[model samples]
Target: MLRLVLAVLFSGALSLPASADVSIKRLFGKEQRALNAIPQTHLVSLLERSKAAKVSSGGITYSRDWLAGQPKQSGGREWRCLAEALYFEARGESVKGQFAVAEVILNRVSSASYPDTICGVVHQGTGRKYACQFTYTCDGHAEVIAEPRAFERVGKIAKLTMKSAKRPLTKGATHYHTKAVSPYWADKFPRTATIGFHHFYKQPSRLSRN
Candidate 1:
């Protein structure tokens, strides 16, 4: 089942041209070949376009057919920030790992210890040697967005997650480390799961100050 889910996610993030639309019609259904594919509006449009909906021409007030449980695209600024960070930091990561990375950032966003917003979470401690949440921000080189393709892929994932798509891949992990880093925090948190080049960990909840 894990491999199956991973396969589906990887297929969603598969290589496509920068202008190519990566959408639900491409991933989930086939009828709506050229539907409007905005992350926030696509799903709603998708249901309207597909035959699965029960649109009535017979007239009943002014109501459109609704899907029971369709996934919505995320449009909030926090979702965008999370997407940008994932794109910049983990575009090379596997699909499962990409979501896990986003989870860590979101976890930090909700934690009392870190910033409450995605931009704040990603840009925390700027200018200092190792200040930014994303190392690329503080690294010597400018954060050049050369790969529009990769960024779009990450953006879609962020949109989906922000819309309440559940990713149970990580075990509520707020931290992760690549196989290369051996930080002091590693031993402090319990190891949760390993996906691709990253290791997920959950920290002890011993803090009293809120």
Candidate 2:
């Protein structure tokens, strides 16, 4: 009698719907293919939206879209100083690279070893050959902004960094030099980050401050 009951239950189970046998992977495969069929521009727009929603330090998030939408107006003296420094030093760099350079400048302003103001720190060694903190300041060439678009981009970056963004992208580095040349001081400090064409470092004693 027990054998008869077991055989009857097994036959009834086999008669259930074939859909019940479908695996999870098979069920989701159709959905995944549909997502893959989306247009590239639409996918990119979705990604940009997600990035814009992400918050960095101090509740600031920067993206190309955000920067492009900013007003094209001049800022105060400090803003001009930072914007000019970025334009001359890293205009050709990637957007993130430009921001990294700005971080170094702001880091110096907050450090004990450097000047407290952006202009002071940027022009620290100007007028002396090979002594300027930034080469453009003492390169003996007029500081003319020939590229309006580039200046505008850096200006937005400067404003964003000065106001709401204070995250240390360069690992608390206060100094950086291009990859084409190795400066004597680079060896004296610990290397922190290498962004785009520049190598960043922080003085060993200043690590605590960073």
For this target, which candidate reaches the highest TM-score against the unseen true structure? 2
Q: On residues 1-210, what C-alpha lDDT tens digit does candidate 2 reach at each position?
A: 223444565576577676654653463465567666878767655554454533366544445666677777578999999999999999987666788899999989988888999999899989877678898999889999999999999998888778855545788888899999988888888899997799999877735431
Which regions of candidate 2 fall more than 4 Å away from where they truly are?
A: 1-55, 58-63, 206-210
RMSD of each: 15.0, 11.9
Candidate 1 Cα errors over 4 Å, as ranges: 1-76, 207-210
lDDT of 1 by residue, 26-140 (tens): 6534433323334534554443334231214311111122211223344667877787788777887755567678877777776787788888878887788765557777888
> In candidate 2, residue 52 scores what lDDT?
54
**Cand. 2 TM to true fold:** 0.69
TM-score of each: 0.61, 0.69
Steric overlap count per candidate: 0, 0
**Per-candidate local distance difference test:** 0.64, 0.79
- The CA-based lDDT of model 1 is what? 0.64
